[model samples]
Target chain A: MTWSLPLRKFLLYAFIIIFGFVMLYPIIWLLASSLKPESLIFSEPGLWPSEFTLENYVKGWNAVGDVTFGLFFKNSFVISIIAVLGNLLTCSMAAFAFSRLDFPLKKVFFSCMLLTIMLPTHVTLVPQYAIFHNLGWINTILPLTVPKLLATDAFFIFLMVQFFRGIPKELDESAIIDGCGPFQIYSRIILPLAEPALLTTAIFTFIWTWDDFFSQLLYLNTVENFTVPLGLRLFLDSQGESLWGAVFAMSVLSLLPIMILFFLFQRQIVEGIATTGVKG
Target chain B: MRHIRKNTITAYLFLLPWLIGFFGLVLGPMVSSLYLSFTEYDLLTAPEWVGLQNFIEMFQDSNFWQSVRVTLGFVLIGVPGQLFFALFIALLLNKGLKGIGLYRTVYYIPSLLGGSVAIALLWKNIFGFEGIVNDFLAILGIEGRSWVSHPDYALYTLIILAVWQFGASMVIFLAGLKQIPGELYDASAVDGAGKFSQFKSITIPMLTPVILFNLVIELIKALQVFTPAYIVSEGTGGPSGSTLFYTLLLYQKGFSYFEMGYASAMAWILVLVLATLTALIFFSSKYWVHYENGGS
Candidate 1:
C-alpha cells in the first residue's frame, strides 16, 4: 500500500526464493546423483554430473525382476488409478449419506465412523493382516485396492462430507423437486458439481497409496509384485555392491507422477488440504 | 418418519462400503485383538488363555519401557520441531508476498514424497557418514559420525525426516492464517502493537482451533511413525537399538519374532494411550481452542 511496502515485498521474494532452493535441494541433489555414475554417487557432490547417464534409470526400473521397467510402472499406475477411483466414488457416496441425507440413526453411525478415522491404521495392522492371511488375500494386489473400494479410509469420507456441507441446500431441493432419486442426484447432480472435491480426494488417494511403503511391504511378498517403494527398498538392501545411483534414480522416477500432480492441481491441492484443516 | 424410510435405505447403501470395511477389516479385528491380547496366541498354536500374563510380562520387559522412552522421545522432540517449523514457515508464507505460490509449492513437495522408502534411503545418505551433512561439517573441520547408523544420533535423522514433512502442517497453518481476519492485524497495528505482540494477542488465539487440530493429528501420526525408524535402523532398530519407535517395535515383535500375542498387547496399549491422549486433548479444548463460531 506504500513505497516502503515495495521494498519489503522485494526482500520477501528474495527470502522466499532462497528458502525454496533450500527445500528443493535434496530432491534436485537426488535427481542429479541418479544421473551420475554409481562410483560417484557419494564420492562427488556438486550441482551437476561430470558424466551424465540414463543407465541408472534403466537399472532402477528393471530392478524389480527380469521384467521391464514398463511393467512395474504399469503396475504402480494401475493400482493407484483403481484405488483413487474407488476412494473418490465410495467416500463421496458415504459422505453424501452422512451430510445431506435424512437417515435413521445417522448421528450415532456418523460418530462411530469418525471414531474409526481417529484410530491409527498401524494399531490395527497386525490383526487386519492376520485376518487377511486367513482369508487368503495376502500376496495379491486385491488387499491393497479392495478395501479402498470399501471406503476404509475415513479421512476421505470426512473430507467429502465437509465439501458436501459447503454445497448450498437449494441444489438438493431443486434436484429433488425435479424428481431425481438419491442415486440419480448423486450421479448427475452432486458428482458433476463436486468435481474439484473429487479431484482432491482422488489425488490424495493416489499419492497416499503410491507412497505407502509399509503396506506394500506387508502385502506384496514377491519381488515381481513389489510396488515402487518396495523395489526401492530392495535396491537399498542389496550387499556391498549395492547401486546407490540406481536407488536414487528410481526414487526420483517414482516422484514424477506426484510432482506433476502437484504442479497441475497446485491450487486445489493446497486449498483442499487447508479447508479440511480449518473445518476439523 | 415415513420419509425417513426411503432416506435410511439410501444412506445404508451409500455407507455399505465403509460399513463393510469397518466391520470386516477394522472392528472385527479390533475386538479380536483385544481378545487375543489376553491370550498367548502364536499363529501356529491356538491362543492359550494366559489371563493378564502378557501385561504382567510387559512390566518386567525393559525393552517395553525402552520403546516407551524412545517413542515418547520422538513425540516429545519431533512434534514441537515439526509444529514450530510448520507454523513459522506458514507465517512467512502468509505474508501475501509475491511468488508465495512458488514458495508453497517447493516447500510442500517434500511432504508429498516424504513417506516413500526412497526418501528414507535418501535420508540415510543425507544424514549418514560421508553424507552431505557430514561433508558440510567436515569443511568446517568438524567430524560427524554415521548419524543414521550410530545410536547416539540415529533418531535425529528420523526427526529430520519427520520435520521435512512439516510441509503438510505448514500448509494447514497457512489456511488457518487466511481464516483469521486480516483486519485483526490492521487494528493491532493501528493500536501501535508490534508484530510479536500482534502475533501473541491476535494470531495465536485466532489460530488455536487449527493448532489443536494439527496437534492431535501430529501426535497420533508421530506415535505411529515406522518407516524411517525401520530403514535408518537397518531394519534392526539398530546401533544399540536407539531408533525403535513403538510401531516398528510392534512390527518386529509380531512378524519378526513371531510374538503375535505380545504385539497385540502392545498394539492395544498403543490404542489406549493414543485414545486417552486424544480424549485428554478433547477435554482440554475448552481452555484454549477458540472456535470462531463461539461456544465453550
Candidate 2:
C-alpha cells in the first residue's frame, strides 16, 4: 500500500521551512542589526534594513578598546586551532587505546573515562580555580589551552572511541597479519577512516572555544585579552545601562564566524552526530 | 606475557597525556573539592576545617532551596521541550526530502553558537522588554514585559532557548530512524498499522536508547545552565533572582560573595543531585528503554 507522495512531501517541506525560519530568526535579527545605523537600531528595528549602513560593523570591528576585533579574532582563532589540533591528536590516540588496543585494566580505565562525563565540571571548578591560582596561571592563557592539549575534552574522546568501535575489527587483525604495528594501523587506518568524527570534533572544538565565555572571563581579566563574548557582555548592563542596539550589533558580529563555519562543514558534523549515536 | 607487556606499554603511552591531565586537572580538584566543602577558605587564607558546618548551613539557606528549585525547573521543562522539538523536526527531516541537509545545517547553527555569549546577548535582546519578542507581541497587541528580568518568565525564556538547540538531538533521532530497517515499516503497513501506530510501537521502542542518551546528556547540560542565566541576569541574577540557576548561585557565592567553602558545598550538592538523577534514569531504563542486544 503505497501512499501519495505529495502529501508527505508537503508535510516535510512545511516542517523544514517552519523550523528553518524559527532557527534563522535570531540570526537574521543579528545580521540586520549589524548593518543598521546606531540611531535606527532603537528607532526602527525591522527584518530588513530601512537604510543599510556599515557603521555597526565598522564600530564593532574597531571598538575592541582600540585593540580592533582583528586581535580578538586572532586570539580566538589561535586558541581554537591549537585546541582542535590537540584534541585531534591526543583524543584519537586515547580513543584508539580504549577501542582497539588490548591492555591490562583497560575495562576499568575506559569506564573511568566514561565516568568523567557524569561528573559535573562545576563541582571541580572551585579546586581547579585554586590550583590555577596557586600556579599563577589564573590570568594566563595557559589554563585554557593546556587542558585541551592533555585530552581533557572527554566528550570528544568518547565520540572518537565510538567511531573507532564501528570500524571492522578484521581490519586491525589483517593489518596485524600484514605486520603493521598498532601505531601504524591507528595512524594509517583508524585516523583516516575517522575523518568524519575528526571533522565533527574539530568543528565542535572551534565552536566551543570560540563561544566559551566563562573561561575567558575568568583568565583574561584585562580588556585587551577579552574574547568576543566577554567583550560583548562587558557592554550590556542589565540595570541602568542597557545598550540594546550595540549589544545586538556585537552579538551579530560574534555569531558570524561560527555560523559561517557551520554552513561550510555542517554536513560532516551532522553525519558525525548520527554515526556517534549508531556506533554507541 | 611479552605481548601483554608490549600492549600494556602501548596503552599506557597512548593514555599518558590524558591520565596526567585527569589527575592534575579533574581528579585532583575533584578530591580537593570534597575537602574544600568542609573548609572555611577564602583564597587569601589557608582553609580551616569546619567539619559539617557548611553542610548544616546549606539546609537552612533559602537561596539554596531557591537555586535547587530553579535548577530542577530548568531540567524538567528544558529537557522534555528540547526532546519533543528535536524529535518533531527529526521526523520531518527523516522524510528524505530535498534540501534536508540545508534545513538541518541551518537549525544546527544555533546549537553550535547557542552556548556562547553572543547567543546569550541575542537572547537578552529577544526577551528584553523592548526586544524583538515584545515588539512582535506589540504587533499582536498583547502587552509583554521584560521576561528575562521577570521572575515569572525568566526561566521559561531560558527553557525556550534550550529547546531551540534541539539540533543535536534531532540529528541523533534522525540516525536512529534511519536504522529502523524499512522492512519493519513495510510489515507494519501490511498488518494494518497506521502512521501513528507504527510510530508508537516500532519507532518508539527502537529509538528508546537514543532518547535515553539524549535525555541523560540534556539533563547534565541543563544542570550546568550558567551562561545564558549569567548574561541575562546581568551577572547578578536580578529581578527577584529569577535567573539564579544552581551554578549561577554557586558562582555568586564562591566568586561574588567570596564564600568559597559554601559554594564548594553547593557544588557537591549539585553533583549529588545530578548523580542521583542519572542513577534514577539508569534504574528506570529497564522499564522504558528497550535494547536489542540485552535480555529482558
Candidate 3:
C-alpha cells in the first residue's frame, strides 16, 4: 500500500510478461527454427532466423517413400471428421436419452456411463485390438472411427448430458403435447439448441483423434494409411540430423489444425474444461 | 400405459448405440482382457490358460519393477509439481490484470499442444546435447549434457515436460478462484487478517474441491503417459531404462515382444492400482475437501 499503484502495476506486468515469454519461447523457437535452413537450426540458438527458406516445408511435405505428408493430412482429416461426426451423433443421442427420457434401469446405465469416464483405456486396449483384428479392421480407419459411432467416448456423452440437463423440460413437454415424437424432439429441438456443446464435442473429438498415436500406431501399418502423428513419428525414425528443419516444419504443420481450432473456439474450449473438468 | 411403453421403447432406441458399444467394445473387451491375463496367448496361437503364471513372472521381472518405479516416480513427483505451478500461476493471473485473457491463452497453448507427437518431438530436441536448453545454460556458464539421452536425467525431462503443460489445470484453478466470494476476503480483512493468513483461512479451504479434481485427473493422466517417453527414448526405453514408463513397457511387451498375455496382466495391475488410488483420494476427500453444500 506504501508503493505507488502505477509502480506496483508495472512490476506485476513486467513479471507476467517475462514469464509468459519464457513459457512460449519453446514454441516460438520451434517456429523460428523451422524457418531457418537445416544447417543453422541447432547452431543458431537465437529465435530470429538470419535467413528464411520454404525448403523445409517443401521437403517435409514429400515425407517418406512415395507417401506425401498431404496423404497423412488427408488421412488425419478423414479420421478426425468421421470421429467428430460419430461423437456428435451418438454422444448427443445418448445424452438426450439420459437427460430427458424415462427408461428401465436408467440409473444403472447412467452410473455405468459415469464409471466409464474414469476407467483407464489400458484395460480395454489389447482386447479391443483383438476385436478389431478379428473383424479385419486392422490397417484401416475403422478401428479409429467405429468405436466413436457407438459412443465409446463416454467423456463427450457426460459432457453433453450436462448440457442437455440445462434445457427446460417444458420444451419437451410442449413438443410431446403437439404430438411430436422423441426422435423429432431430439432432432428438431435438442440438437438445434445444443449447438455449443455439440461444437465443443466436435472440436475436442477432432483434436484428440488427430493427436491420437497409440491406436493409430497399432492399426495403421502402411505409409498410405498413416495419420499426421504416425507420419511425424516416421520422420523421427527415418530422418537423420540434416532433416531436423524438415522435422520441425512438419511438426509445426501438424499442430496448425489444432492451433487454429483453439483460436477460433477458445471460449468454448475453456468453458468446456471449466464446466466438465475435461482435459483439452 | 401406452405412452409409458412408447417412451421406454424410444429411450432404448436412443440408447441403442451406446448399449451395443458398451457390450461389444468395453464390457466384452474388459472381460476378455481379464480372461487373457491368466493365459499365454501370442495372437498366433490359441490362448492356453496358465493360471497366474504371467502375474508370477511379472513380480520377478526386474524391468517390470523398474518400470513401476519410474512410473510411480513420475506420477508422485510430476502431479504435485504440475498442480503447484498451476495454482501459483492461477493466483498471479487472478489479480484482475490487463490482458488477462491473452496471458491465459498464451499459458494454455502448451496444454493444448502437450499431448501431441510434435510437442514430444520438440521436447526431445530441446533437451538434446546441442539443443537450445544447453545453449541457454552455456550463457550462464553451466555445462549441460543431453538431458533426454542421459540415464540420470531422462525421466526428469519428461517430468519437466509434464509440469510445463500445467496450463489446463491453471485455467481450472483460475475458474475456481473466480468462484470464491469477495465478501469472504472483505470479512477476513475486517477481522484484521493479513494477506497470507486470509489466503490460508479462506482461499485454501474453498479451493480444495477444485484441487482434488485436478489432482485425480492429472494423476490418472500421468500414470498413462506414453508419447513423450516413447518419442524421447525412441521406443527403446534406453539409456539403461531410466525412462521405462509402465505403459511403455506394456506396449513393448504386448506389441513388440508379442507377450499379449503378460501385457494383459500388466494392464489389469494398472487398472487395480488406478482404481485404488482414485478411491483413496476420494475417501481422503471427506477429511480435507470442503463443499458449500456440505459434501456431495
Candidate 4:
C-alpha cells in the first residue's frame, strides 16, 4: 500500500528530530550543567537547570594558580594561528613544486611524502621528543609550531597537490609567457585561486592544534604555557575534590572557539570532508 | 642543458622546507626510534644498546598484552559499530527531506569536538555515578552504576563514544550515496523491486568502495584512541587498566615513566600492526570493493 507523501514526510522529520536531539543531548546537557551550581549540577540532570549561576565561570577562570583561563585561551590562539599560517605557506609551497614544477628525484620525494601519510605520529613521537629536547625546543611552542612551518604534515601537502592538479596547466604556461617566474605565478595566480583549499587547511589546522592535548601535555610543563586542552586537564588534576562545576564551566569555554568556527564555516568544513572523501 | 639544471634548482628551492623536514625531522627520528627500540634509555641518560630486550620483554609484560587486547577489542568492535551508525544515518539523510541541513549539522557537532579534552571530560561526567545515564536508568526503575568506573563496562562506554562521532563517516557515505545514479533507483522501482531490495542490490554494492575507505579510516582512528581514555580514566588507564588503550600506555611509558626505549618498541609494534591491517584491507578490497569504471 502506498502511503500519503505528507504522512511519510512527517515520519521522516520526526525521526530526524529525535535522532538529532539524541546526538545533541550531551552537549546541551554540558551547557546546562555549566550554568548550574555545584550542589545542583548532579541533583538536576535535566537540560534545563532549576537554578542557574555564573559562579562556576567566575571560579574556573581563576581556578588554576595565578594563570587565568584567559592565558590558556591566548596560548591556544597563538599556537593555532601560527600553525594555520605555517601549513598554508609551507604545505602549499610543497604542493606547488610537486604539481607544477619538474625537478631531480621528484618521483622519489613524491612517494616519500605519500608514505609518510600512512606513518602514524606515535611511531616518531619518542625520538622526535628527544630531538626537540636536544635542540632546546621542548617546553616551548617551537616544537609544535616549527614543525608545521617545515611542511611536516604530509596530509595537507597531499590535499593541496590534489587541488593544485585540478587547476589547468595552461594558466601556468600563460604566466610563464609573461616572464612570470615560479614564485610570481604562485603568489599571483595559484594562491588567489586556491583560496577555498587554503581556508580548509587553515580551519582544520587550527582546530586540530587547539584540540591536541597529548603533545602539549608532554612538552609544556608550567601552567603558564599550557594550551586550552592542557589547561582544562589541569582543572581536573589539580583539585583533590574534583571541581565538577569548574571543570564543566572551563570545558564549555574551551569549546567556544571551535563552536564559533564550526557555525561560521559550516559549509567549508563539510565541503572539505566531502571533497577529500570523493577525491582522496 | 642549463635550462634543465636551473629548473631542477628552482623546484628544489620550492621544496626546501619539506626536504629539510623529511630528512631532519621525519627520517632521522624514525631511524633513531628504531635504534632506540633496541636500547635502554631514560630521559636522564643516553641510550645504551640492549639488543632486542625491549621486544623480548613486551611478550612477557602483562600490561603490554592487556593494552594489545584492549586496542584490538576496540578496533574490532568500535569500527563496525561506528560504520553501521554512519551508514544508517547516511541512509536516513539520503531520503532528501526538508531542513536536512540542520539535522546534518547537529549530528556533525560531536565529531568536530570529538577529540577535544572538553568532550572527554563531558563524557566522563555523563557516565559518572550521579550523571545523566544513571539518572535515566533510575527513571526506568533500573539501578545503574558508574559505567566508566566499572571494569566490565568502561571500554564499552568508550566504544559508544566512538560511535557517537559517526558524522564524518556519515558525510562520506552520503557523498557516496549521492554518486549512485538516480536512474537506477527509478528503474528498479518500475521493475517492481521494493526499497529494501533496491538498497541491498544497488546501494550496498555501489557503496562498497566508500565502505572500504570508511573502515580503514575508522580502524586506524579507533586503534589510536587516546584523549577520551586518558580523560575518563584520569590518565592512569585504570579501573584496572580496562580503558588502557595502546597509545595511552605508550605515552605513559615514554613521557610519564621516561622508559623511552620501551615506549619506542611499543610504538614500532603498533606501526607494524597498522601497516599489516591496512595492507590486508587493500588486498581484500580486490575481492569485494566495487568500482564503477572497472570489471569485477
Candidate 5:
C-alpha cells in the first residue's frame, strides 16, 4: 500500500531510531550498569541507574594486588603504539615495493603476499609458538610486537599497495631525474602523499593489537606482563557475582580508547573496510 | 643493464622487512607446523616421528567432533544472519536519506568494538539469567532462562552477538549499493516495475559480487571465532560444551594439554577445510556472482 511521503518518512525515521537504539543498547547498558551499585546492576536493568556511584571504577582500578588497571592500560598502550609504528613503517615499505618498484620475481612475491591475506593464523600458531618459546620470548611483548615490525600483517601491506598505486609514476620519475635515490623518493614523495593509508594502517593496527586476546593469552603468563585483555580475563577468573560491578567498570575502561579512536577517525575506519574488506 | 640491476636491488631493499616476516613468521612456520602435525612433540623433547597418529586420534575424538559441529553451526547461521541485516540496512540507508552519515556512524560503532574482551564480557552479563535480557522479557510477561549458560541456546547468543556487529558489512554493502548506477532503477521504474521487483531485477544481480566477498570473509572469520565463546563460557567451552568453538578446543589441546602435535593436526584440518570451502565458493560463483564489466 502506498502511503503519503511525509507519513512514510516519519515511519522510516521511527523504525531506524528504534533499531539503532537496540543495536547500541548493550553498550549503553554496560555504561549505566558500571555506575550502579554491585547489588543493583542485574536487578535494575533500566538505562538510568537508581544509585549512581564511582565505586566500581575505584574498586576495579585496584582489583588486582599491586597490579592496577593503570598498569594494564599502560601495557596495552605501549604494545599498540609500538605495533602501529611498526606496521606504518614496514607495511608501507612493502607496499611501495609492490606498487612502484620493478624487481625480479615481483609477481610471485606479490601473489604470495596476497595469499597470506587469506591464510588463517591458526595454521601457523603452533610452530610460531614453538619458535618464540625456543627464543626464550614466551613471557615478553616481543612475540606480539616483533612480527608486526617485519610487516607480517599482509592486509595493511595490501591496503597501502592499493593507495600507493593511485599515485602518479611521473612524480617518482622526476624525483629520480633530480638525483634522489629510491629511498629518498619513497620518503619525500610517497610517504608524505600516502598519509591517509598510513594513518588507516596505524589506527587499525592499534585497535586490533589492543583488542587481540589469543596471542596475549598464549604469550604473557604472569600478571605483571598482562595487557588489558589478559587483565580483564583475570577479573573473570578471579571473581564471581560479587564483583560484577567492578568487572563491568573495567570492561568499560578497556573499550574507552577504542571508542575515542572510533569517534576521531570514523570516516577513515569505515572507508578502510569498504576499500579493503579487512575483518577483525 | 646497470640501471635494471640497480632497480632490482632497490626493490629488494624495500621488500626486506616483509621478506623476513614471510620466512620467519609465515612460510617457515607453515612448513614446520605441517611437519609437527605428524610428530609427537610436547616442548620438553625433540619431535618423535608418529606418522598419521594425530590425525587418526582426531577422527575418534568426540570433543573434536563437538567443536566441529558447534563451529559449523555458528558459521552456517551467523554469517548469513549478519549479512542479511547488513544488506537490509544498507538498502534502507542507500535511499538518499538525510543525516545518512550519522546513522552509518552510529551503526558502525558496534563492529569497531565487537572483537574486544570487554564486549564479550558484556555479552555474558547481558545473556545471564538475571541479565538485562531477562529484565526486558519480564516486562513482556515472558520468563527467560540464562541464555549464555544453556547448552541448547548458548551458541545462539554468540550468533546474535555476531549478527549484532553487522555494521562493517553494512558499510561495505552501502558502498556497493551507492556504486549501482541510479539510472538502472529509473529505467526499471519506467517499465512499471514495483520497488520489490526493481530490487530483485537490478539490485540483487549488481550486488552479488559484494555479497560473495562478505560471505567468504565472514565465513572464514566465523569459523575461527574464539573470544566470545571463551569469555562467555569462561574458557571451559560451556555448561555442556555447546559453545566449544574449533579454535577454543585447539587452544586447549596445544596450550593446556601440551599436545602441540595434535593441535597442529587440528590446524591443518581447519586449513584444508577452509581452502576447499573457499575454492568451492569461488567455483560456485561463476553462475551467480555478476560483474558490470563481465568476465575479466
Candidate 6:
C-alpha cells in the first residue's frame, strides 16, 4: 500500500509474464520442433519453425516396425478407461463402507489402508510381478487393470472417503429408516452427491494411468501391446540415428489429451490434488 | 447387537473388492517381498533361504552405496529446490493479479506431464550437446557439453527437472496461503509491522503445517524417482551411474539381472529408510509445526 498502485501492478504482471513464459518454453518448443523439418529441429534453437513441415507427423505415425501409432493410442485409451472406471466403482464403494457402514476391524483396515499410502510401489513391484507372472497375466493389460479394479490406489479411496464423510449423516439415517440397504444408500445417495470428487478421481485415474510408463514397460513387451508412453520411447535412439523431429511430433501428440483435460477441468483437478495434500 | 452383526456383514460385502486387493495386490506381495529379501530367488527358480546374506551383501556392494548416495543427494537437494520454487511462486501468485488463472494453468502444465516419457526425452534433448540449451550457450560463445551424458551434470539436470515441475507444491502452497486470514495481514499492517516481519511472523508460522506436508511428500517422491532417470539414462543408469536412482537400481536387480532376493532386500531397505525419515519428521513436528485449533 505504500508504493503507487500502478507500480505494484506493473511489477507483478511483468514478473508473472516472464516466469510464465519460462515455464511454458519446453512445451512451446516441443510444438514448434514438431512442425519443423528434421534437419532444422536442433539447428533452430528458438521456439519457432523457420520451415514448417508435416513430414515428422507422417513418418512418426508409421515409424514403428509393424504396429501403427493408432494401435498404441487405442491400447492406452483402453487401459486408462478401465483404470478410471475401476477407481470410480471400486474406490467409491470402499470409501462408502469406510465412511458410512460399521464394520468389524474397520479401524484396523482403515489404518492399514492409510499405511499403504506411505509404502513405495516399488517395494511390492518384484513380488507382484512374480504373482502376475504365475497367474499368466504377464505381457497383458491385466496387471494394470486388475489392481485398479481391486482399488489398490488408496489415495483415491481416501479422497472419496473424505468426500463421503462430508455428506450429512441425516441422509443416511433417513434412508436406513426407510428400509434402504447400505448398497441402495450408496447407489442412490452418496454416488450421485459426490459428483465432483468422483470426477476428480476419474480424471486423475485416466491421466496417471495413461502417462504411467514404468509399470506399463515392466508388464508389456510386445509392440502390439505398447501404450503411448512405450510407443514414444520407441522413437528414441541414443546410440543409433535418432529421429528428433518425429519424436517431438509424437511427444506433442502424446500430451494433447492431458492438456485438454487440464484446461477443461483445471479447477476440479487443482482442488482435488490440493485438498488431498492438506487433509492428509 | 444383531443389527451391528448385519451391518458388519454388509460393510464387509461392500469392502470385498478392496479387501481382496489389499490381501492379494498389496499385503501378500509385501509379506512375500520381505521373505524374498532373506532368500535367494530368481523368477525361474524357487526361493532358497539365505538368511541375512542379502542385507549383508547390500552394505558391501559399492553400487548399492552409490545408489544410496545418489538417492540421498537427490532428496536433500531436490526437495528444498522444489519447495523453495513452489513457495516463492505461491507467494507471488497470492497477490491479486490479473490473468492469474492463465498464469496458474501455464505454470501447472509442467507438473502435469513431468513424469511422462516425452518430457524425459525432451529433458534429455534439451541438455544434449546439440540441443536447445547448448544452442543458447552458443550465443554467448561458450561451448556446451552434453549435460545428460556427463556424470557430474547428469544428476543436476534431473534436479533441474524436479524443480521445473514444482507446480503441484506451488498449487498446494497457494491453497495454504489463501487459508491464512486476510485479517492477520491487515492487523499487522495497522501495527506498523514491515512486510518482511509480517511474512516471518504471520505467514511462515501459519504455513508450517503445510510446509511439513510438502516436505514429507517431496521426500518420499524424491527417494523413489525412477521414470525420468530411466528414460534419460536409457535404462542403463549410465554416465558412471550418477543418474542411477535407488528404484531404478532395484528394478535392474529384480528384473534385468533377475536377482530377486537382492532387489527385495533393497526394497525393504528403502521402506526402512522412508519409515525412519517420516517418523523423524513427525517426531520433530512438535518443535516447529503449529496447530491453530490447538489439538496437536
Report per-candidate DockQ.
0.60, 0.60, 0.84, 0.69, 0.81, 0.69
Q: By the TM-score metric, which is better: model 1 or model 5?
A: 5
Model 2 clash pairs are none
Error of 4 at B203 (Å): 0.4
lDDT of 4: 0.89
Clash tally, candidates in order: 0, 0, 0, 0, 0, 0
Tell me the lDDT of model 4 at B33.
93
Ten-residue stretch with the least lDDT total in model 6 chain A = A271-280
Candidate 6 on A1-280: residue-level lDDT in tens? Answer: 3889889888888988998898888889889989999988876667768898999998888889887888999999999999999999999989999999887799999999999988999889889999999999999999999999999999988989989999999998999899998889999999999999899989989888988888999999999999999998886553577688888888888988898888888888888768886220
Q: TM-scores, in order shown?
A: 0.94, 0.92, 0.98, 0.97, 0.98, 0.97
Cα deviation at B207, candidate 2, in Å, is: 2.1
User: In candidate 3, what are the lDDT values of residues B1-296, reduced to their tens digit?
Assistant: 99899889989999999999999999898999999999998887889999999999999999999999999999999999999999999998998898999999989999999999999999999999878899989999999999999999999999999999999999999999999999999998999999899889899999999999999999999999999889999898877999999999999999999899999999999999999999999999999999999888
Give the worst 10-residue stretch by lDDT in candidate 5 chain B. Answer: B287-296
Chain B TM-score for all candidates, comma-separated = 0.94, 0.94, 0.98, 0.97, 0.97, 0.97
Show the colliding residue pairs in model 4.
none
* Model 4 chain B lDDT-worst window of ten: B96-105
Candidate 5 residue-wise lDDT, A1-280, digit = tens? 8899999888888888889999999999889989998888866656899889999999999999888999999989999999999999999999999998889899999999999999999999998998999999999999999999999999999999999999999998999899998899899999999998998898889999999999999999998899999999987777544788998999999999998988888778888888888653
Candidate 6 or 4, higher DockQ:
6
lDDT of each: 0.83, 0.82, 0.92, 0.89, 0.92, 0.90
* Interface RMSD of predicted model 5: 1.1
Q: Judged by lDDT against the true structure, how good is candidate 2?
A: 0.82
i-RMSD values for every candidate model: 2.6, 3.0, 0.8, 2.1, 1.1, 2.1
The most accurate candidate by DockQ is 3
